[model samples]
Target chain A: MFQWSKDHLLLLWLRLAASVCAAILLLVAGFVLLEAFEALRDIGPVRFAADASWHPASEADQGLYNLVPMLSATLFATLGAVLLAGPLGIASALFCQFYAPAWVAQLQRRIIGLLSGIPSVVYGFWGLVVLVPLIRLQAPPGPSLLAGILILAIMIVPTVALIAESSLAAVPEAYLLGANALGISRVGIIFRVAIPAARSGLLTAVILGAGRAIGETMAILMVCGNVVAVPESVFAPVRTLTANIALEMAYAMGDHRSALFVTGVVLLVMVVGLVAVTASFATETTHAESTHG
Target chain B: MARGMVQTSGVSPMTRQPRQRHARWLDGTVRAVVGLCVAAVVGVFCWIVGDLLLVGVPELSWGFLVEAPIDSGRSGGIAPILVSTLAILAVCLGVSLPLGTSAALLLSELAATDVRLVRVVRRSLDVLAGVPSIVFGLFGNAFFCVALGLGFSILSGGLTLACMVLPILIRATEEGLRSVPSDYRHAAAALGITRTRTIWKVLLPAALPGLVVGLVLGIGRAVAETAALIFTSGYVARIPTSLLDSGRSLSLHIYDLSMNVAGGEPKAYASALVLLMLLLGLISMALSISDRWLSRRMVHT
Candidate 1:
């Protein structure tokens, strides 16, 4: 009885802590909603969302809060980053899994670990000095959409590669042996059998990388030009939703401040949407794996 | 029998050599492509670090570490900024570790892993992990600083960071606990040990390295953050005497120095160098310690 009671007490204590962790996310969402309510009440959701011009600097009554410009920039930059990173990340994973000598693979893995460990601010600083200037010489107004995409691509490559590599490693050795027995070449086996088998895991890697690219702030803030206009080309300056929030939060007051909170709500919604997609892919792969096992 | 099989196939040795040569050429080409990708990563790292050191090393001096900002950070030191960063880190780690470990233990040992409640908890953690730091900054401003009446202080910033890093900590700790062998539990039970004692005495020690890895990662996130801290901590440059006092972090100091203050670019570079060194130190220390611990555990087991 005493043992059972002690066990029960411990379980209760742990359950409380677990609930605390869970409660935090709810609270964050709740607080954001409560704060965003002021802006929604003042400007109906449709008009606020439909309008593309976001000139919040005007007098409070004359303000306009369309988010399409920044939203498109965010999507554009993330998509570009993902497009660049996805192939390289998957290719690197294949190299590590199949082609590289053991020591070379270890060295690459360590470098990747160090890369991911470096802070985003450091990357931003580097981009501000090096990448921005390189872009400036090639195209005027150097802090352009291309710079943001490139920096984000570099930042996410390690993450995507690491995840993809792990998934590739999880591919059963028996499959490789079966391919070998059929006289398939090493490269042929890797492309035809291994990659196809891990396709869902590879997709998960890309989705997670996309999430990182979208959520990224400091690095993009330094190089994305912070302009509110829609970007016409890769060399055009634009602002992301995240960059906008960071750039203007200091002096914004009353409804202007509340509008930024609404922007936060939008960012939250986008990220949650991405997470939902990632979760579905993750579960689907796991379910398939379990049934195969 | 193998020789007879080759003879039966009736392929000349001359044809076989060409096939072998073709296979070798393919191998070399594939290896070269992969090698190029690895080189690109190395090149980027070297370029960033090399450029920073060339520009930043001359500006770093003993005076820079000890002195307070003068002339809007065009000259003087980052003493207060360093202190405030440590204070925030302390608060963040203090709040996160115990709660995260407890939650991980609950999930690994007590709860059924595939249950609805467990699934809900894990899913929410994933969503929390995916939320942008900027959004967290807004939420922290609204909830921690304004509504909770903490009022733009280190306490508020730390609390916000704590929430931001909780998902990572929980995931890491849960993985650690799950990795421990089930035989330890069975053996403890056979010895008439209570479930609580078994976890404290056996499971935790075995899971220590994994937990440490999580701790290191959480520390990294807390240290690197700027936007979230700006709202919650309010960016006061002086050292805080109390938890409620506002503080400036190293990342924010670099941002302000470079962008807001005039003639502050050199100082920003110098501080960026310092931040880089600190992160490198943390990562190296974590890697070495975990490696040693794992090796030692292997020898013992």
Candidate 2:
């Protein structure tokens, strides 16, 4: 009887602790949403989403919130990163999965592990010192959309490659054996069989990579020229929704502060949406695997 | 036209010979492309690490590691930043580990019987893990700094980072707990030991390795974090005396020195080099430790 009560008490404590963690996440989402509603109350959702200019300082009194230009910059960087990282990441996964020697594969894993562990600030410092100057020699402004895109691409490649490699590795050995029995070449097996088998998982990897790239702030803040206008070219400097919040949050007050929270809400929505998509893809892949087995 | 007429005249294996040759060439091209992509991945890693060491090694001196900022982070060392970074790391790990471990225990032991509860907990963790660090910063500012009235101090930063690392902890620790064999539980039950005692004595020791891995991973995230700490932990360059005192982290030090202060670029590089090495050490340790633990478990089983 004593043992039973002690066990119940311990279980209760554990459950309570776990509930706190869940509650914190809920509170964060709710708190940000509440602040977002405050901003929306003043400016409404339509103008906040569709306005082209982001002149928060000039219209601070009236709260003119324009997120189009910043959202475009964010989209351009995310898309650019996906375009650059997707092929390299998938191909490297192929190398790791099918071609590399065991030691080489292990070494590749270690390198990517270290690369992914590297902090965004360190990447930003490297970008500020190396890529920014390299760009400045050719272009007038050192920090531009191209710099942000390049840095984010490099930063997210390891994530994409790691996930892609794992998914590729998970492809059944029987599939490879069957392909080999059919007299398919090594390259043919990888491209025609292994890749197709891991397609959904690979898509998840790319989506998660995009999510990482878009949520990135300090690195982009360092390389992306914090201009408020619509970026005209890849060389044109721009701000992302994240950079906008980081830059303005320190000094913002009242409705302006709420506006920054609104940007956070937008970022939150996009990331949650990406997470949901990736989760669905992951579930689908698992379901397929279970059914096959 | 002549070639087409010839293929039509002999359309069996004669035409197939050229097609096979073309396919071989295409296969070779694809192989080359894959190899090149692999090289690019390795090359980029080398480039970043090589560049940092090449540029930053000259500036790294014993004096640089031990001294405080002399001229707005231009001429001084990173003593204060190191101390505060370690402080925040300790505070965050200390707070998150118990909460996360208990949470993992709950999920793996108690809630394992409840399918809906497990799904909800897992989905929540996924969403939390995917949330942006900057948003964590915002939430930290509003919740910890303002609402809780902890202000912009290490306490707020640690609390925010605790939130950030909780999902990592729960996921890793839950995997650890689940990996423990049920035979141990059965043996304990056969001995007439209470369930609580069995869990405490049998399950936790078995899951220690996985819990260590999770701990290391959480430490890595806490150490590398900058955005979440920026608002919650105000960037004071001096050594913090308490959890409520604002302090500078190595990550924030690198960010401020490089971006805000003119002539602080070299110091930024030096700090970044240190941060990179620290992160690399933690990650390598995490990998090797987990690998070793897994192998040892396999041997034991």
Candidate 3:
């Protein structure tokens, strides 16, 4: 009876621990929302939509908190990164799956893993020193949206490649063999059969890559020139929502600080939405596999 | 075209030769393109690491790791920053390990009868994992630094990192726990072992490699973090005497040196190299642990 009671107590404790952790996770979102309420109420949703630049007032009266430019910059950078990395990453996975020798594939996987583990700040620093200067020779004042995109693309390639490789691996050998038996060429089978089968997984990879790119702060903050304008071209300097928050949160006060939280709210919504979409895709993949199996 | 020829009808030997030749060309071209993509990724990796080595290696010395900064990090070693980074990592792991393990246990061990609870926990963890680190920074600042009144201290930073890394640790550790064979649990039950004893002695030992991998990955994320810590832990470069004191992280130091300070490039490079080497060591450690675990399992079976 004592042992039973002790085991019950242990279970109770575990339950309490789990519940507390879950509540804390919920509180993080709630806290951000609660804090952003001040800015959202004061700034008004209409004002955020209005065509104005980000000039947070030091005093009480004169601030324009338009998030459009930063919001657009965030989208543009993420889009550019996904566009650049998606094909390259998928291709690398394909090469590993089909073309590379066993040792070479292992090496490639290890290298990609190492690339992912390199700190974002280091990537940012490298971009600032090397790529920024190289861009400057072509276009003066090289810290532009292009720089951010390139850096983010590099940062996210591993995410895409690793996921894509696993998904490609999940394509059953029987399917490939069936295609081979049909006298389909290897390249034709890959393009037609394997890729089509792994479509949802590939989409999940791209979406997750976009999620990483969109939320990225330090690297984009370092390379994106911190200009408060919508990018007219890839070469144009721009600031992202993340960069805006990081650049100002250090010194911001009152409404300005609340505005940063508002930025956080926007970022949280974007990420959560991406997560939801990925979850749906994951379910769909599993469902399809279940039905087929 | 070759596929078309193969599918449609039997072809004459003369025509089949041309078609086979065309198929070979197509395969070769596709192979070259895919290989080029792989080469590009590897080449970029080489470029980044080689660049760091060329510029940063020259700056590395014994003094670089053990002295305080001078002139706002223009010239000096990173002893204080190193101490602070390790301190923050310690606090982060210290807080996260218990919470993450318990939460993982709830998922892997205790929640089997409650599918709804498992689904809810899994979904929330997925969402939490996707939340941006900058959002985490803001939350830490607002909740820990401001509301909790921890201020810009290592305690606040570490707690914030704990929150950010919890989902990762829980997921990884849960995977580890799940990988343990159920036969062990049955065996323990046959021996009349308590549930806790089975978990502690039989399950957790089997999951140690996964748990260690997860811990190392969490440490890597916390160590590499800059934006999240910038507001929570703060930018004070002194060696902290307590958790309440503000301290600079190595990543933050490198960021400030390269971006904020002029003529701080050399030290920044050196700091980056050190950080890179540390991360490399952690990665290899994870690899070796998993490798050894796999070998042992193979031998045992």
DockQ of each: 0.51, 0.50, 0.55
lDDT (10s digit) by residue, model 1, range B1-301: 0000111133466677777668657867876876787677778878888888999999999989989988878899999889999999999999998999998897788666436667667778989999999989999998988888999899999999999999988888888788788898888999989889988999999898889888987898899888788788986898799999999989999878866787888999999999988887777767676667667768867
lDDT agreement of model 2 with the native: 0.87
Where model 3 places Cα greater than 4 Å from the true spot, the runs are A58-61, B1-19, B295-301
Q: Rank the candidates by DockQ, best first.
A: 3, 1, 2
DockQ, cand. 2: 0.50
Mark the 10 consecutive residues where model 1 chain B has the least summed lDDT.
B1-10
Error of 2 at A94 (Å): 0.9
* TM-score for chain B considered on its own, for each of the candidates: 0.87, 0.91, 0.92
The local distance difference test score of model 3 is: 0.89
Q: Which candidate is the best by lDDT?
A: 3
User: What's the distance in Å from true for residue A262, model 1?
Assistant: 1.7
Candidate with the greatest TM-score versus the true structure: 3
The segments of candidate 2 whose C-alpha lies over 4 angstroms from its true place after superposition are A50-52, A59-61, B1-16, B298-301
**Tens digits of lDDT, candidate 2, B226-253:** 9898889988999899989998889999
Please identify which of the two predictions, 2 or 3, would achieve the higher DockQ against the true structure: 3
Best by DockQ: 3
